[model samples]
Target: MERSTEFLSDIDMVVGPRGHRRWPDAVKAQIVAETLVEGATVGAVARRYDMRANHLSEWRRMAREGKLVLPAVTEEPKFAALVVRDDVETTPDPEPRSPLDLIFGAVTVRLDAGTSAARIAEIARALNASS
Candidate 1:
C-alpha cells in the first residue's frame, strides 16, 4: 500500500495557554452586576470581559442562590406593604342604573335597576312564551 502524507501539510501548530480559566468571585459579581445595568445584556458584558455568556449566566445564578455575594447598592430599595382587612364589610357596586319597564298588552312588568341583559332577555322570552 502507498503512504498518504498529503493531509499533514494542511495542519498548523497552535501553541498557547488554552484551558479552563479561574474567575474570582468579586470579578464574577462585577460582571454579573454589569448585566443588571439598564439596557445592558449578558452577551455584551461577557464579550467585553472575553468570556462566554453562559458562564456569566451561571455566575448570575450563583449570585441568586447566595453562592456568590454581589456588592451592596448605593441606594436602599423601599417597599410599602398593602394591608387588606377581611373584617371589613363588602360594599355594593356604585355604578348608576336606570329603571326598565316591559309592557305586554294590558299587563306591565317592572324590572329592578342594574338587572343583567341575560336576565332581561330570559324574562322577555318567558313573557313572550306565556302570551
Candidate 2:
C-alpha cells in the first residue's frame, strides 16, 4: 500500500493554528523612520502605533547598526559651542565705536512743527539708505 504525503503552505508556516498577528515589515519600517529620522519620541510613536516604546527602541537600534533598513528621512543638525580668544587684550569701555562710525557719522534731522507725513517718510528712507 502507498501512503499519501501532505505539505504545509506559506500561510501555515507563518501563522499557526492559534490566531496571532505578527508585525509586518512595513510597520517596523514606519516605527524606525518616525523614531530615528523624524526625531519623534519613541513613546509617542509607540502610542500612535499601539506598540511598546521599548520594542520600537530596539528596532531603532537594530536599524542604526545596519541590521535592518529603514526608509530614508531627514534629521535636524546638532550644534556645539566653541570659544576662541585672541592674544590682544582689550578692556571694555562704557562706549565703543567701530570704524564704520566715522564713515557714517550720526546725522540729526530736524523738522518744523508742521512737517508733512511724506517728507518724514522720505527722510526716514534716506537715513536707512545711508546705513
Best prediction by TM-score: 1
Each candidate's clash count: 0, 0
lDDT of 1 by residue, 38-92 (tens): 6899999877766689988999999999999997775567688999889998999
**Where in model 1 is the C-alpha error above 4 Å?**
1-17, 75-131
Displacement of residue 77 (Cα, Å) in model 2 is 9.8
- lDDT, candidate 2, 1-131, per-residue tens: 54222221322323446834365665577667877644578898777655578988888888888877887666568788887879879888655433221122567666664566787777777888978
Against the unseen true structure, what C-alpha lDDT does each candidate score?
0.77, 0.64
